[model samples]
Target: MLLPRCHRIKQPASRSLFQSRPAGRLFIFMKRIGLTGGIGCGKSTLVDYLIGQGMCVVDTDQLAREALSPGQPAYDTVMESLKGACRLEDGTLDRSALGHLVFNDDKKRRWLEGLLHPVIRQAWESRLHTWDREGCPMAVVVIPLLFETQAQDLFDHVICMACSEKEQLHRLLQRGWSQEHIQQRLKAQWSLKEKMDASDGVIWAEGPLSSTFQQWDQIYHRIVSP
Candidate 1:
């Protein structure tokens, strides 16, 4: 089902993601794809696979992490906003502590998003522009909250990685997350069903690793070959 469910590259990426950039920059439009899903849904694995296939991938989570690292502009802003609530002894952000802070308090989470989302989006958009100018054929941006953040415009096609909630919880637990921690994080994002319904294609991430990846490989070939 996953292999047969490939969605082709759609035309006219949402302009909202790059309205600020100059127009008519690229002779050939770079095929931009958005990869999104719930937390612990094997997005990293898919990203690696895509990267091995020579795709330029922009992982927004990694962007966010780098943005909030010590000495970064957003790092200063977060520390100032949180009054140094979860900083480490080395003056870097204590992400685990910060996660606990934001996950438990909706207000703080929203505030953090307000501060982080624009910066991350701008960073990736700039990269997309770069790739297009460089004549890159295709690129993927991994944004877990693509639909929730209204960032679908950032890509020509959107793909969702989905597995059962039980499988999701199991994956998180393997990562040393407590049941409560898993629940708290999952509650913040749209459910797998909702994401899959909204995406142009869905990668049902169940069963063996090879099986999951075979699904993604088919979708990739369809997008790039079509």
Candidate 2:
């Protein structure tokens, strides 16, 4: 976690017009990095490390949860659209029930995505732009479905977490998901290799998290270096 000082904060050659001056600080390019991977692939660990290093992050999962809370636009929309099918006895939306409904049917999955993705995307992108305007040097957006959602254009760089299938299943099992459930989730998204191939950077996560951090540190310097 010992990242060197990004004193110079150089921009990559391909990026354009991100450099902005802020009083006495070094000119920093507004960086919006997308962090993504399969479920339980340690994106949270990386996000914690980024926060520790003073980077702002928008967690789309958190935003999606907020959207489902009562009085939110998405909550009202779902009730009107789905006719309370996802509702619980106490009147709260049954998240587990909704999840089960979606995971089994491609139509349901697309319907849920259609309901929530736009709101979540706008929320995070607006936050990132606001931070950039306020002189934040860099920010991260943790989107587990970044590729699936076709949101790669929203970032200056996308860093994907890659690991063996065995490791991915092991981590999910630790979270109490069954193998059948894991398979369902996996089938819905691009494989780890495909994500890595499409990403600007990949953090190989077959080993310890410190190793993952080490890779990020290297990518950090590479992306921000002269």
Candidate 3:
């Protein structure tokens, strides 16, 4: 991808007195961009391209995994809520087992979300603030449930990656996922049409990778420009 250099970065805006405090305490304003897409829409690939274009990117999926690691607060809360229903003999939580418990059942899914979302939100906010303090020009947040979670308001702009249902299914199958698993994961997310309607911009990912990279380049230019 060949992205235009950021005009904003070349011309730093003047800061208010509040932003011109002591070096260690000074604050910097950075754009918060939300990147979302449906399952199998190649969102990770898009984020990678954006990162290559010099945008600081945060992976919510990776953070979610971190939030549930053995010693994490949310992990302890989840274990207490599940009460050994999702635990292994070795005392660690069985994530695959827990996934089966919630993915197929809406009530259980909501219950788990209730337990985890708050912690995830807290962590996300802290990271955002830290990045802002460090003077990052802008950042991209890779959120898979941006629409479903009603988190669009959290970002200055939202980008949705999209593909045809057939293409999505084919991509999932290529990853060796079963048909049932694909359907279940799809059921867990809003449809592509819904996400596109709610997004500030859309990147179509059904074509070749080269074409997708070209779209990414265009988006990078738009994002970094005023």
Q: What is the lDDT ranking, best to worst?
A: 1, 2, 3
Candidate 2 local distance difference test against the native = 0.79
The models' CA-based lDDT, in order, is 0.83, 0.79, 0.76
Q: Which lDDT tens digits does candidate 3 get at residues 27-111?
A: 5467778888888888988777777778788888888888888888888888887787887888777878787779888898988
Residue 203 error, candidate 1, Å: 0.8
Candidate achieving the largest lDDT: 1
**Shift of residue 211 alpha carbon in model 3, Å:** 2.1
Q: TM-score winner among the candidates?
A: 1
lDDT of 1 by residue, 152-189 (tens): 86568898988777777888999898888878888898
TM-score of each: 0.88, 0.85, 0.82
Model 1 spans > 4 angstroms off: 1-27
When 1 and 2 are scored with TM-score, the better candidate is 1
Looking at model 2, the pairs that clash are none
**lDDT at residue 170 of model 3 (Cα atoms):** 83
Which regions of candidate 2 deviate over 4 angstroms? 1-27, 88-91
